[model samples]
Target chain A: MDEVLLRAVVPTVIGVLVRRGAPFAAAEDAVQDALVEAVRTWSAHPPRDPQGWLVTVAWRRYLDAVRAEDSRRRREERVEAEPAPAPAGHRDDTLQLYFLCAHPSLTPASAVALTLRAVGGLSTRQIARAYLVPEATMAQRISRAKRTVAGVRFDQPGDVRTVLRVLYLVFNEGYSGDVDLAAEAIRLARQLAARVDDPEAAGLLALMLLHHARRAARTRPDRVLVPLAEQDRGRWDTAQIAEGVGILQAALARDRLGEYQAQAAIAALHADARTVEETDWVQVVEWYDELVRLTDSPVARLNRAVALGEADGPRAGLAALAQLDPALPRHAAVAAHLHERDGDLATAARLYAEAARAASTVPERDHLTRQAARLHAALRA
Target chain B: MAKYLLLKHYRGAPAPVNDVPMDRWTPDEIDAHMRYMRDFAARLEASGEYVDGQALAPEGTFVRYDGEGRPPVTDGPFPETKDLIAGWMVIDVDSYDRAVELAGELSAAPGAGGAPIHEWLELRPVLAEQRTATE
Candidate 1:
């Protein structure tokens, strides 16, 4: 049936449950149980009003458990607190679900798991497989997270920063199993951007969109690494690139420039070019300068060096790189590229081999090894 | 936390400080070494760090498609291809240091004279499903 629509409305149903004076943890559990049953039976007999159906089922599920434990008086109190079933199209109720999932009391891992479960409407099995964790471990983490935020008010104020961070974590983890976590993250971020006027939320959405655009060209069919300089620009998702840039431009116009906005600006510069040679490296390097100023992260500084090389010269890039620690991941590979461009093939080859030894991933190591082999073959020729 | 592969080569890697080939080692030493490796992997499993451990036969042939309708061309397993990988242990740990610690323990499996092998185990990080470098 309509799975996406069901997930989108799940938060609203959960909000209704929480608003009914159900414990946050119990309400969430009941909503998930209802969702599972909906998936199994909906194909046989789809409901005319999915949201209303979900609400009735989940609310009843919540009541059934609480009824077994409570006396008539306490049951009446909860029943009195239950809000009348209204149109589930209200965005604020869903927004509160996002906040509750990203509650500050939970660890980032727990927050990400909870957000995917509660806001993204993902089952524990799907979430566990997506993250490569055991199902039992994921279950414990989600239950623990639910318990941690059980005391949180349904309308409690939430930090947008924590919410953004949790979403970023989901986006960065990529995707596996039945859940496309990157797409899920983008969906959740889009929802977050719509509800909050926070520019950073839009900025994060833009960043995810822009980065996701180039995903196809990032690897070969056999899974070999494709360097950015060589990626086929035609393969990029032009529609997503345009949407991301437009959103980023609007967010930048808000004048509350955030880290995500700065990052998106650099990504947009890369997306704007028709070819690698046409890329606006000067602007990218400038944005990196701003990024280094804002965050002072070593990773940003390292990337800025590569952009510096394109904008200026390889020697200039090496000079910028010299200021940073060589122990940084990918440092040797960057150095090797710069040296190769500077026409020092021997040093480049050595560094490439060294970098391969330290490479974190199989494809990266293979790529670096090929670089070294290519240089050696050139010398022999 | 990231997962790493501790790759041990049958050959091609630099010789260990002990310089004792497993074939040349005494039978008791060989048994002890094998037991040590097995126990190390089991201990890792108990600690929830071991994802997998696999040993290759070192006898696989290279094969490739010849044409649209033809059978695949199988090439010789050349003796000159000296960089032969023996096996690897995949470990999930909280830090690179922990992966290294486990790799170190694996390298210290007994050699001749019942001494540590001091072998080289290449530690490589397993990248996630997509391009993380895209930022």
Candidate 2:
């Protein structure tokens, strides 16, 4: 079968197996087997009904495994006792899979893995590679997560916020493994937005598209981390930016303000600017204010301070920064940036060094270290 | 998804018995060794198989909390310890077999003289709770 058709059908097949009370792990295996068969068989002869074909093949695979482990009599009984086809026109069961995958019981990593497995129809190896973990370790984490949420009712709806959070995490990982998680996240988010009609999902999808659109300009061939203000605007993906803006406009039309919508608004403002100096920092700061109300996260507040600095002045940004906790991750980096903008090169250089020490990733540390080196060299000159 | 910790041990391995010191190796050999490690990391990144990898300082200071009214006591590099960890990589993989496969690849990371070490790197599965919830 074509890859796109398979991707669309696999989740529906998984939903059927899950509703049949197949354990998440077994259902996943069965679906994978069916997908393999589909790839092998369907390439030469496309199925008349792809979803039905997948469901039938997957059910048989599941029963084959179950039969192998059970007594002959029990196996025969199960095979003969297959439940009636799910009633037509019933609510789609895939949403429950989304909820179960996002079940609060599972940790974020587990939740993301489960979502990719069950909803995205990705294999354990594929998921493991995407997350840069060993296939075995990722497999165990996914299985454990499935067991944790095995009790979730099929009909129960899951928290939209939780599901969105998982998708956000997936998008933020940026492309690392064999797959582009950012694209996968967008695909999943589109599925979710269609299912739930949630504006925040749209908002988040828009935000991701907007950010991804700028990815080309975010780094140079030498692998340096270019801050947004310094990024080459010409390289930004205008198509993605336009799509994001369109989605944000629709979401904003709903008038139900959300954290994601506010953030998307800010991203949209940035995308609209022809040059960094032309950025509407005043409107961006206003949206940040809305975002701070929606999600009282310190990171949001810290970001708002940067916008405030751009809209108002460096002193105003510094004053806003003073109110936040000193130990927040990247606090020193933000301070360094603000001080550097304020022309306190000495303090900026010192904080840059401090930030470099606290940087969590090699690229981030390298960037900060470069800042410190540059400033220190300038001082010597 | 099982989690495996690939631990690098700085102990219980035969010391290099070659009469020539590492410094005597051709510059190209040393460059090859560094390239091997860099390539290994790049491969892991491409495969989306790396979780977290770090090189640890050989020297470690030990600190212990004291009784209720006292400050914690700090101790030294603990010369008595036999199995010191040089570094480690935590990988989340799909099965024990895949973990072994990756570990086998990691074991081939270049050592002195640009040769694959193939040394024993202990593989331990991290307990689930210890894993950070965030990616």
Candidate 3:
């Protein structure tokens, strides 16, 4: 049995049950149980229509659960009528699941977990391992999120932006587990993009694809970070970049500009360059200006400064950087880069050392430390 | 998520509020402290914050390589002036603030007279091996 195909139907089956009056939490649990059974029995007796089979098995499981739990007796009465196991319609309620899982009431962390479980079709254990949290802790977080949205109507329109943010969090967060969360986030984003008419959903999918295209070039064999400018351009997946840029262009043509689109535009520009010197820094700076105006985020402004340095000169970048708070993360690193470009070895070395001290991840700290050491050695020579 | 090491010093840290030596404490008080510690670990595990906790033996030795031909250089089970850690707990939490909150809770483990120890625990972040995609 194809596991991906099996997992893909999970949200659809759950959506069917929820629409039929089962609680979201119970429906989700039942679908998980049905999925386990499918793994066990599908080889012997493969279902002709996978989604239909899943809906039937999952619905039965839901009824059994409702019967077993004393508190669900009233809900059990409501769903007692068993409709014939006809093939589930192509009507996609998975979109509703996306909105429910990313409900605004849930904390950002909780929202991410719920989205991974409910829409991404990942198990609690998988999510816990991905997040480096205990299974019990992750389970509680997911259940709490489910409870928070338990009362929400299945058809109530969800905030598309909230769903996109949750998906983005899943994509960007680091995880060293069996599951590739970046891939999972892309899968969910793709599904959302298809179901929703919003251009931002497409934009988010485009952004994820663009970033994912460079996964191989992002690190060294021993897992050291390779900064974008230094990464081997040949290592990028051209096919993925083509797809991302294509989608981005379509979304941009709609003229519904969003931060994700702006970010993807920057990523596409980087991908377009074969060498560091060939990068269209002028266009990158323009995109950053759009991003800064759209979000007014300090980090965006900080990044725009780096592009400005490349487009104009190191002095111009430093002048722009000087306006921002020095305490912002990576501020020292950016300052070091611009100073080094300005031919100020001493200042660059000092800032590199400071950046290394402030680095959060081991690889980044090592990379910055090496940069500092290299500058220091050159000064000595 | 971030991992933090909560270090409990045996001798180096400034005295806690309930500063009486463990040996000087009544047997019941000792039991209470131990019980409190056990419960704390259990609670953290249930909440999914706990990674590991361990108590270290007070006696330790220092060793270093002498040369390619020699066995090694050895030093004393260091004196009281030398900082010795009593124990350590590793926790994976969501934020620095949460780590601080948990460390504060751990410091409140019962001590002599069954009062909060209020010990100073050194909290240090464990450098993450994986870099986030956005970074």
Candidate 4:
């Protein structure tokens, strides 16, 4: 009945309910009800075995809901036929919940939300705030997502790729709302990596760590975006960079170079540099080539152009840029960078302005606008 | 969690047969409409659902920074843009479905003659780190 024990055991109980084939919405609701009951009752009469108590109460609540829905017969049959709970040492309940939430049947959005709710034990409002949607809308989204995967077999093995994708999505949100989604994502990824030996997952974790290591230097206090080349290297997290590099090395030794692994390799190269001039641009460009081959995305190709510019020259970068689709997001911005390097200030200024107009985020727009402003100021001076 | 911007647009609905201007509405009807929105926001705030919701001014301007000697160029709120936004609500929801539900609730807000507008709201998942994450 201890508060810490309750918090630790609640997610596991929810996972058990979910794994037992309860719908996510129903399982979540039932688990929450159990927790509330525990808070009220345990304060006066503490239980000796909190986990056992929670499981008993949560299961009863779940059954009650089924009974209320008039599906008692069907649910009872399911419950009766369900496999016996794994012996305590046979499986980690928290990991099982992670796999269930990351089930391929759920869309990426739903998986992230469900995982955050069930595993992260975040409130729907908290999740909504993190994602920046109305609470009512978020509730509906999670419910619809649950309904979408209502028929998915809970016993089926989950796709590691999908699980990694969802985890990466969590980390990629960076920081928004009241939560640090990036850090949370890393925490989940660390948990996943510890529970499962997935090289790509490790690669993703490494990539995230490498990127996050530079986060302190990636933005100004005034919210201005700082390009990687412009970042102060001293401000980066060296310890995290070291851990990420080590993970990337181990993942590379697996002899399988997935896109994430290749990206991680490139990130490792970036993090290894003590200064901008020390960056192994040639190696970085080669890694980008590998990434481009694996993903074949225009964005990858565009990014490779930046690396190419560093490895070769501005002309080569521009040549690579010419081969890319003009409609690719941030094409103008990349082009401006190449033009700036090529000493065509007027063209760079114009492209910077166009890039600013095409920017998707406020920070991107501000960064692009500053580029244009810098050029204009130089021209006037 | 990613943040999303829910944009409400006055589009794709049956044309109003009884087109009464807002100023001409009965005072009680106007009061009812305002009360509905206020109550809706209050409910959301009470539930820790409120983030930032605001009715936008119909008017907008497009500004272009010219060379220092030339000054700025300005364009007004266009009359013919059929896709003009009416308002926006920013919420931090767990998933897209939650955003849709909140949008559905917002659509139930009172409008002309105290009827729910049910206007289309475009839900856009804010793309911050598309390169790193799929969602």
Candidate 5:
């Protein structure tokens, strides 16, 4: 049985229940129970109509839970007391599910957890494992998040940016455990893009694709990071890059110029190049400028400095970097690179070592350490 | 997800509650300990938490560059001063608490008299890739 296909229908089934006046948590729980049953029994009894089957099963399960809470009522009254079942409905509710799960009231982590379960149709255990939290902790977090959102009305639309932010967080989680959350984020983004005409959704999808395309070459065996300039570009997934570029082109045509589109455009510029030397640094610098203005983010400015260094020269890059706080993360690494380019190998080596000490990830630390080692070896020779 | 290293040390960590040397254990007790460890790893794999693990050989060599034109220099294996890392099991999990829980479980592997060892396994967080271009 195509579990993904079954999972894809989950939001709509829950939406049907919620529209029928069922509490969001109770309806979500019912749908999840139905999903578990589906996974177990679908191989033996595959339904001809998956959505219809799920809606029936989930609605029935919701009733069963309610009835079991107090079996004092006659079966006829139980059926009558229940809200009339809403129409089985089209796939349109998936977008609503996204908005509900990404509701502004929920914390980002809680929203992400809720979305992965209610919309992404992931098991609590799977989500917990993906995040590295113990199953019990994740369960409490998810249940708490659900309780918070239980009262929210689904009719009023939510801010699309909030939804995008949640999806972005999911994508940024990248890969760990068994699930590729990046891929899951892309899947949800694609679903959102299909339902909404918002260019930013396309922008987000484009950005995710562009980054995901280079995932294979991001690290070497044993998870040692290979910096962009040194990565073997042959490993990049061409198909994903093409798709991202296509989506980006359409978003750019809208002329909205959101932060995501700008980031995607920068990524596209890198992807279009045959090698690091071939990258259009000038155009990338322009996009970074656009991104900096849109978000006014320190992170964007930091990236802009790097691009500026490439577009202008190492000295110009250093000049741009000088405008920012030296305490910013990776500032030393960037400084080290620009210094090495400007013929200050001794200083570069020192900064590289410093950067290595502050490195956030194992691979990044190893990469910076290797850079320092090479520079030190050069000095020794 | 956060990745962590669970380091089993031959020395240096705080003394375990079960402080008896492995050599003191019966052969069957040692076998049971190994089996428990293997099963622990297997369970982590089935749960999608395992990344990798390895056991170090007892001996190791330290080398250094002498000069550009000279052969590299080698030093004596300092078994006395050195803190021997017996092995490491890497796991990717959601929270620091979860990592601690796993470490606690690993330390419970059977030891002398086939009772829980309570060995002090060092739990260290692994650094992660940058999510943004700037930070």
Candidate 6:
């Protein structure tokens, strides 16, 4: 009956099956079957040891599938040569599962799908609903992903960066249908942080926590985006912000800075402020500098320009913005803000209109359009 | 039930009755227009008639393969006179009449002076999969 408890143990159960000589693909499918059965009967006959019960049922399912295949291929010896029982020490193979699901050979979409299923323990139906895709399409994607990583060996440590990237993608998917992907990302990140010694893992967890803490104030009920400066600070989750800042402080002390840590640090600063005017723009600008140096991503630089506008003056922000390609995403929006700050309402209105035209999402376009409309009204006044 | 596409255009469609450009509309008028559009979509979703809705950016390039090992040739971001698709909504309705009624409602979204835009929307039926005929 405890869905969270069920999902949390999924990867671990899958890991246990893999160690017991089941092929990775077959083990994942078998675990999914076990999960369905658990949902059906677990409430009426709750197992005293959920993990043990899942492993037993999943292993049996795996054996039945192999036996069916054996009969077809006439390879009875393979089924007979089952490996020795794995040690019952409860070694967490969840981290290895993350690496396999996020295998470099798979496409990003495939990796994300596989990770959500094999590592996050989400059902294909749930995943499909979250993504607004047909359940059959999601199943095909997960199947393809499993096949792609079937040959992958988990003997070596996975690039923590790859796993982090996959988790980040999941987080950005936000919420839809029955699943809150952001919360799921946070849960997976917490699990990964517990197993890995990487500060970046902790940093990623902190970053998700900080961003998620502001979810309530990020939009209006009508789905219009509320700008960061305009968001109701009282709506921000104080406890989550505190947790994020504490994790970020610990990561910063390690002195091995990464992009996620730097991003988290910026988020921590924003959360630190009680109001827009109280925000430490100087520190925010500094973090943006670190972010740009670490990633050299245009997005970071564009954001840095906004911070600079607030920290120094609108001129400084506009000057920084001038260096980047005008074609960059959100470039026009940034330019509009800087121009508006510089008292050039005409230019700001024009840029806002352009930004609205180019916006990729409905909410973003609506937000930008409103901005342009506001400025145009002011100009007419 | 059959699926139909209700298409809106940035250009190439006949000029609407309320022909004022969106940028020229008052802020309140613009907000009203957006609200009308959202409410329409929400109603369709509530009735289980909505499949999908999306708005596209005005700019798009036309690209085609040039030759083996050569970069694809590309054309202009289309001119204003060209028939540019603004966006579309896909709906599964019980009949063609229902699709037309929904499209009509959508085209009546508020525009300048809080009046209906009465914009032209092209309603097209989506071809369904071939059916297996029963004996």
The top-ranked prediction according to TM-score is 3
Question: What TM-score, to 2 decimals, does candidate 4 have?
Answer: 0.73
lDDT of 3 at B88: 95
lDDT of 3 by residue, A1-381 (tens): 587767777788888887777788998988888888888999999989888888888899987776666445565446445434444467678889999999988877778888888787788999988887778878877877788888888899999999999999889875467878888888889989998898899999999999999988998888878899989989999999999999999999999999999999999999999998999999999999999999999999999999999999999999999999999989999999999999999999999999999988888899999999999999999
A295: Cα error in model 3, Å: 1.6
Q: Write the per-residue lDDT of candidate 5 for residues B34-113, one digit (tens) a residue.
A: 99999998787655567778999868889999989999999968868558899999886767788999999999999988
Give per-residue CA lDDT, model 3, range B1-135, as digits (tens).
678999999988888888888999999999998898999988877655777889999888889999899999998886855588999998877688999999999999888788899999999998877656654
Model 1 is docked with a DockQ of: 0.13
Every candidate's fraction of true contacts kept comes to 0.13, 0.07, 0.47, 0.14, 0.14, 0.00
Off by over 4 Å in 1: A67-91, B4-135
Each prediction's number of clashing residue pairs: 1, 26, 0, 22, 8, 0
lDDT of 4 by residue, A113-134 (tens): 8887777766678787777666
For candidate 4, give the DockQ: 0.14
Q: Of the candidates shown, which would achieve the greatest DockQ relative to the real structure? A: 3
Tens-place lDDT digits, model 5, residues A127-241: 9877766676567768878878878887778888999999998998777678778889998899888888889999999999999999888876676667888879999999999
Model 1 over residues A127-153: C-alpha lDDT tens digits?
878877666656777887888887778
TM-score of chain B of each: 0.93, 0.78, 0.94, 0.75, 0.93, 0.93
As for DockQ, the candidate ahead, 1 or 5, is 1
Error of 3 at A51 (Å): 1.6
Candidate 6 clashes between residue pairs 3 or more apart in a chain or in different chains: none
DockQ, ranked from best to worst: 3, 4, 1, 5, 2, 6
Residue A255: error of model 5 in Å?
1.1
Expressed as tens digits, the lDDT of each residue in A1-112 for candidate 6 is 4888798998888888888778899999999999999999998999999999999999988988877887778755455645566764677888999999888887676788
Kindly provide the TM-score of model 6 when superposed on the true structure, using C-alpha atoms.
0.75
- Point out where model 2 deviates above 4 Å: A19-24, A72-81, A84-91, B1-135
